[model samples]
Target: MTRMFRDPVFGLDADVVRRSVENVAPPGAATDIVDLFARAAWSGIAEPGDSTAGFLVSAVGASAALAMLVERWSADRIVRESMVDVDTAAFATQLDRALVRWLPRLDSRSTVRQLTLAATCRAVLVTPEHPSWPERLDDLGPHAPLALWLRGRTDALRDTAHSVALVGARAATGYGEHVAMEAGSGLADRGFVIVSGAAYGIDGMAHRAALASQSTTVAFLAGGVDRPYPSGHSNLIGRIIDTGAVVSEVPCGGAPSKWRFLQRNRLIAAVGDATIVLEAGWRSGSLNTAGHAAALGRPLGAVPGPITSAASAGCHRLIREYGAVCVTTVDEMAELAGMSPGETNEDAAARSSEETRVLDALSVRSPRSPGDIATRSGLPVGTVQSVLGLLELGDLVAEKPEGWVFVPQRP
Candidate 1:
């Protein structure tokens, strides 16, 4: 078995040090491999307890020839080894220049903390060699990211057979909230785990609805999986950690940033079987995810809403101009995910519409006179007065001496 360690940076997973120490080849060459890779990764010297040293050790320990090259091979030789056939000297020069430019940034405290956290988060770090790695991501070719930082259920990651990303504006309206809940809950019922960023507004509503339905959901964070952004959803994020996964690439302790947010959406698009835009404005970030999904030739879906709604404009534009499929019910989302919508469960109505009507007749600020119900519901005043009498009988709505209004059962 590959020896693993509890990495202090990531909190739980096997640390690079453990992997290097146990897996180092040639038996007695452990110290040599560790020293060479650590120094190469940290500019030809080793520092105790340094993560940069750990990374170097892990990267070069895979091949002793690569390890030795750090001391002997020029940048050209390094490039030659990296590819099947390339100009060795020129490649070495290019590699050296690139390393010179890139290595300093790695020394930054922020970068160190982020990479260490990334290495440790419960999320598994998948490599190209990992059997569970999805081949479809190779479609991006060289443009694809180096690796993925995954949290939540690994089954969802390994099963690329089907998944859907549902995203929208964070500042959701009542319509957006209702639609997000319906879509998320409906998708969950259909066996499609809802995937989304755990932002406020639509994202929060979608996660809550998915959880309420007792279905799986995945959240992709722009920062480290350990650090939930927006802080307000810390509780909801905790629930997500329990029921689903939280994912990132930048490593633990990485602060959420504008660039990372946009970059993270590409993973959501590539991994998902489809991407759905429930609600967004012209400037919404959700559209970026949609664009990536489209570019990847994945099926894209959008929810239709009132044209007058600014929040709906992005969805409308995608459907009307970009050929995105229009969806409403969970069945549609399920079919798009290549699954069948299972039988729906029925829940007994806790309150009837008549009871709701009575409650609506009452205002939070003041009692609505019996005449107010007639105006609000477009019913005859006599009918309204009778309904009010029944509601009053039920103690749902109250009648003030001056007129009538609502008094909630609670506060």
Candidate 2:
């Protein structure tokens, strides 16, 4: 049955009681409050609570008499014993002056064909009330968003419950971007949904790799999903929405804000089963996401990089100080996602002898220069260089100030 209550802020009879109950209840939690009412009018900007009619006159002026009365009656009790009345029209007019303010401007147009397309693709929005909504996110406590707007197959959210957020700096080094790609592709191939911000650098690489590998990926936006903030990654955002989802709690037209970005990190951390810092600097926002992941008691991992590089500072910090595990391969990420590594069989042995020879020539100690490696490995310099480039791209071998170092990460 639709009922009405004296809205403390708006004055006209509004469904404030139901809305308040929905806001306070944990995601998916329901209450049987037959008579939920506003015994106390929420006052103050930062923290609004309850109030009595007598208190309203003094605290909110005589105009708020009805609101204050409703609040006082609505207190601790589930429903009020009796309804108090006053002039709501006058109170609403007064509140309008205090509450009316302009929202920030939004971008003229965003390249979010993905979001619109998702809706067209029959993707559904899963608010807190949805049975499929993740309860673990409640670990965020009050910081959790009121709702999680999903725009892909809802099954992905439920089935990929073991997702891990892979995030890092936008100004990523080649090493960071490569690792992100491998991890993203590897994890996705294993059926894990890759979650990221859809920003450039590590985020873009991760999403692209997953799509390239035909895997699902979700992007959590700081602003409206329609407005891919960076603008440089419109293509990636579009692809993600094509196969996965782009979600945000801010209204559809809300502009991005620094505070909103910080807040958005918490969602990425809470929604996933774990988090991996692919690449980040000393003060990168990825570190903030890691903090949220750790605070929620989720397993955190970091891909270590060259000690000399500033881009890996955040990852190193997590591993050394914040207790994040060090991971090097997608198999490890799959394990973290609660899945077994994929099997490699005899078909892998169908490789040409030249390819195997080239793989063997790359090493850490006594690392051969490309020219020398070509001669030692008894192959064309072009072939050796090509193979070495692949190795370098994989982060298996890195060139240091001293020389090339062969780093064999976990299988």
Candidate 3:
């Protein structure tokens, strides 16, 4: 006989709930199915960075909290039942306001639909219980995500010890893009996972350069992972999915709004060990990300640009007023992340010209035969084969059944 979960709180079919979440639940985590469903529902009901909702869930567990909501428990009753240490009268008033905000979106059917949509999109629901959940996000306290909707490799989130958030202006200048490309690829080579919003200009260039360097890069989306925002970067997001990850606190099918975009910046700041603003105007949104990093006490760096350029103003402000480290090179950026750049510099110095040429000849997506690589790199096939062997051992290039391709190292 098959056991069924028929909790009236969910207002969802037991089989449907089981089927939708069973595979998507993080493997090896001792997660209760009903609790997972409750958390998923809460994710859609509460807007991003809802501290009151976080308080409620933390007070009595997600399942119990949802059950209380379903049972129409009064704010007074909720505060009393939660037994949290606080001014009961004031807490009840706050809870009442939160209830008013949460009650309108408490449709279980909609939540189930979102869950089904997540399953359809092949996305995973990563709760705090998951081993891969980025622990650094806990620093957000009540503002942290209850669960993350993730697409692509889950390992990307698990390996955040050496992550850097590269954020800046969407209207990036040529100088900004050049610096962004250098920092992105250089940091990647030094074994740091690049994190960024998938917006155009500096963010897009940062992601592309990381991919080109054959390294893991994660994008934090303001909208649902299913509906890639900025629609222009759909192809780029797809490439990230192939190797890294696309993550969001919003449930599947949620739309990105200005408020959500601002809140999203906090996650970018929280997840990374350090954050760098490559270029921005005085009022650029990247400054918002920088602000979050500063508040979290994460190492913050800003690349200095020409004083005359408007695109550089935010970086200048961060350095001059906000106490951000002035980072002009990848080595400086690495130091900002508390990594000594000496070994990386020595390794870079030791690499022969042939190795660089062979690497430059390989494509991240398309595989090429040694003879073709030799022709493209202007090296003899024998030398190309020798260099390929060395690069393969270094995990920079991989041999596919078809031929040779650039392989991004997973952090």
- The TM-score, computed over Cα atoms with residue i paired to residue i, of candidate 2 is 0.58
lDDT of each: 0.62, 0.60, 0.86
Give the distance in Å from residue 57's predicted Cα in candidate 3 to where it truly belongs.
Answer: 1.1
Candidate 3 residues 1-411, lDDT tens each? Answer: 111235443776677777777756765577688888888989988999999888778777888888878878999998887887779998899889898999899997888778888888788889988889999999998899999999998888886656899999999999999999999999998888999999999999999999999899999999999998789999999999899999998999999999999999999999886899999999999999999999998889999999899999999999999999899888778766645453343443467879867865776567999999999789999999999999889877899988998765333
Off by over 4 Å in 3: 1-6, 343-411
Best by TM-score: 3
Identify the candidate with maximal lDDT: 3
- Each candidate structure's TM-score, on Cα atoms with residue i matched to residue i, is 0.63, 0.58, 0.82
Query: What tens digits encode model 2's per-residue C-alpha lDDT throughout 1-411?
Result: 123233433332234334433332323334322121121121111011112322233333332333323343323121122232434555444334323311111111121322233234343335444566667766655444444445555555654455779999999999998899899888777667788888889989998998999888888888765567789888777777777877766534456778778878887888776799999999999999999898877778898999999999999999999999788888666545433345221211443456445544544345567677676568998887677676578555677665454554544
TM-score for candidate 1, please give it: 0.63
- Give the clashing residue pairs of candidate 2, or none: 39-71, 39-72, 39-74, 39-75, 40-50, 40-51, 40-71, 53-68, 53-69, 364-406
Error of 3 at 341 (Å): 0.4
Stretches of candidate 1 exceeding 4 Å from the true structure: 1-16, 19-75, 84-101, 107-124, 128-135, 340-411
Per-residue alpha-carbon lDDT of candidate 1 for residues 1-411, written as tens digits (9 for 90 to 100): 121212332222334444532332211122433332222233212221223223323434323322333344555544444452545665455556555544444332443344345445554444444555556666555445444456656555554434578899988889999989998887776566678889998888888898999887878788767788879999998888688777665555557888778877877787776788889998899999999899987778899899899989999999998999888876666545433244221110244455444443445345567677777656778877777787678565576777776543331
Q: What is the C-alpha RMSD of each candidate to the true structure, in Å?
A: 18.7, 17.1, 13.6
TM-score: the better of candidates 2 and 3: 3
